[model samples]
Target: MKDMTAFLPYASTANRPPLRPKLAPSGAGASAYATGPKAAKQTQTLRDNDDTELLTLFRNASFEQHFQPGSTVLLHGDPADAIYLVVSGTIRCCTVDSEGRRQIFAFPKKGDFVGVSDIDRWHFTAEAVDHVIVKSIPRLTLEQELAVNISLRLEMRTLMGGLLARRERQMLTLVSTKGPERLYRFLEEFAATRSGGGHIVLPMCRRDIGDHIGLSMESVCRAFSDLKRRGLIDLKSHEKYKLIGNAGRDATPLPLHADL
Candidate 1:
């Protein structure tokens, strides 16, 4: 592969693309965009440059597959011939022990890519949490592109790096955080990924939460109550929760193994 570093400026903090506003400005056109239409156009161009390239690759090379809730989208040890890019709904990736214990690795949602790390066979099983749609791109196609497309190569590296970092953080949290705090942290991160500001739906049930965070269903319920009592979260209903007051950011850090 050629040097991909030059094609991946958006991957770095210093050169990352500008954020697109939820709504365009309302003032005079010149003042609204900070420096007139020319600057605004430039900003838009920079933002869409790399994103358009990647989107084109997926759109041109992938085929869509839909899965119903509880359906297995990918099985552990299955041939890893394609990468699935989530289009809608959630996919829970997990592994089960010989004793039948399950540990969830991730709940990948829209815009997330799966099976990117697999070499020959899947290491985790992916199940649809609801009606799910994904675009599957064959590994051979991506590899051929990567051989000549520097931007795609760099983007792949960036994606893998992010996945590894997230897993590392999850492992550290599981070992060092209390159950209640763990639940709170998960809500915080989950809400951040979602679009609805402080309000978001819990796509998975309490049992799923327990499996993901290493808690029992009863313990998960208790942790929810604890968070509600602490004024960190407001449970609107069985599936909806609203974050309150910094969402426990002000709480003192719990000692490692405090739940023990």
Candidate 2:
């Protein structure tokens, strides 16, 4: 198959595609939207944090699914029923070859969406890396609703864009760089994620990371050792990693997106 990531930009989109905004800027054209209950809702959504907005969005979801650790959410050939919104826990997206080799593409966590595909059958399988809860909306429902909800439409588009960016980053970084750079990029991305109180916890195991990046477990371990030796990152435990600044980070590092 063709490597689509080769052509993808290693950085974030310089200018994202313009979405029709619900909140209009001040001026003559803003006359209709400037004052109303709709305008007040938009204003509040803007002022409120992302979690609040996400909560509001999920309140209207068609349904939800829960998966315990190691449970499958989607099979490779399963008919695409709905696009999923992750409420909690980690989802491991992967595929198994004819030889039964597992190649994981990504690990999407909370506040992420999955299962957007062009074909009716799923191209990949999604399983819970940990206990997972996801809200889902049927394809027909999303298409019909998105037409009316501008904000939801924009968000869904943004989610798709985020997936593209992540795949690009993953493939480009894995194939072009050594294990150290891959590890660094992974750490940097996760640092910005659920990390708090001076520590960044890695959600994937060494073997999973190795499989995802086409590296060996030994190589991944070596990369971690090298990072620690250079004081770039401190390994508190197998799962807990603390970022110590980008002491030896790549000058042109990849921007890792989570919603793959």
Candidate 3:
């Protein structure tokens, strides 16, 4: 597999740290760093040796399997036995309509976690957008850890919070913004997160982004055109954008970082 870093830009700030796989310990008596407010709060803790060890434990304690591009990792309503970590490659979480149209919920990159739903079954299907390697942690093991590990508890809490926040933001964009605004914001946010020296590589297709942002495919195309026209972004081609600096750029994009 290609080095995951090669596929994406580096973190923009020197102070920013790499993401780690370990969930912080949960339960009482956990360190303050492990616990978050009832709401999600962004934290920038570095990935330490402990976190690396935890990832190793997670991978070795269970088994890892590969899925070819277009393979389904979990179908909607399937039993949610384990949470998946994308060791490499991309996965799209999506839901299908009664008419059988697929609406992608999210495109998770390498190092992103998937299937963290609290329900016994998955609410959406997870399919490999590319050849994918996943480290699976049994749900029971995760639950057990959550019961005892304060740090993990906090980490999980933060993760849930971040998910909710992202969903809320997406919902607002769908309801309140036009297609061009949504697309511009999306590209701007993607660019701001990068090392500031390179273009943002979109891991998914325009159709996938359209579904997530509640835009029609044609509208998604128009939004890209609008951004390019405004000189906010260079449409390097479909699914790629180069930030050229524009007004009304996303403020949170550069500052936002997450563990999963």
Candidate 4:
């Protein structure tokens, strides 16, 4: 659940601490620091622990809500007193350009976090893409709970690390990719986030996809048709897709670390 301006390069530095900290033990335990199965297992265990704690936080916050499709959940510059956890439906976050054209930032999915920025105000407006369910957590409560619980603190630190990694990947894609590549990569990466393999259902329409990826609706459609002709993806419908093998890039995208 990472929602922040981190995906967009910011001119002003954020207030949050470094996501990855140097935790190498000095001298004494250095021998055990070598890469091995135990170290890998420990890393996995840490992630598992953090997920459990995050679930607990969501439950304790107890501010569950449902929004009808197209409802505004938050506005740009709203008081940043809380963050959100989506249980279902997509949240489309956006902001207006200087010329008043709306620019969609992201389509955050189930289990995605919204407003995870450390700033005092929202950076973008968030709207329900469909019927949406979420848990809203006050920043004060989140901070107080983290302060008293060492395990929770550790979990938050780890989660933030993953979020930072994702933000980096997104920024890189946005800065570097061409239209067709961005569209293809976006679909590939978004599909990777689904726990169920293949047969991906895009939550956003073509216009939404174009807005997020900095492309035109025509470009997105053309890319899809191209990929379909190339047999890279099976288009059951405009929104439904089936990913075939041999995409001729890296392996299937790692989940959550997606943008273009």
TM-score per model over all chains: 0.75, 0.69, 0.70, 0.70
Poorest 10 consecutive residues by lDDT, candidate 3:
7-16
lDDT of 1 by residue, 170-211 (tens): 999898877888998888778888966556898887877888
How much lDDT does each candidate structure score? 0.69, 0.62, 0.61, 0.65
Off by over 4 Å in 4: 1-50, 247-260
For model 4, the local distance difference test gives: 0.65
TM-score order of candidates, top first: 1, 4, 3, 2
Look at candidate 2 and tell me the lDDT of residue 80: 76
Quote the lDDT for 246 in model 2. Answer: 52
Please give the lDDT score for candidate 3. Answer: 0.61
In candidate 2, what are the lDDT values of residues 87-113, reduced to their tens digit?
A: 788877877554345667878888777
Comparing 1 and 3 on TM-score, the stronger one = 1
Q: Write the per-residue lDDT of candidate 4 for residues 41-83, one digit (tens) a residue.
A: 1122223444566667766553666665555666565567777
Pairs that collide in candidate 1 are none
Cα RMSD for candidates in order: 15.8, 15.3, 15.4, 15.9
- Model 4 scores worst on lDDT over the 10 consecutive residues at 33-42
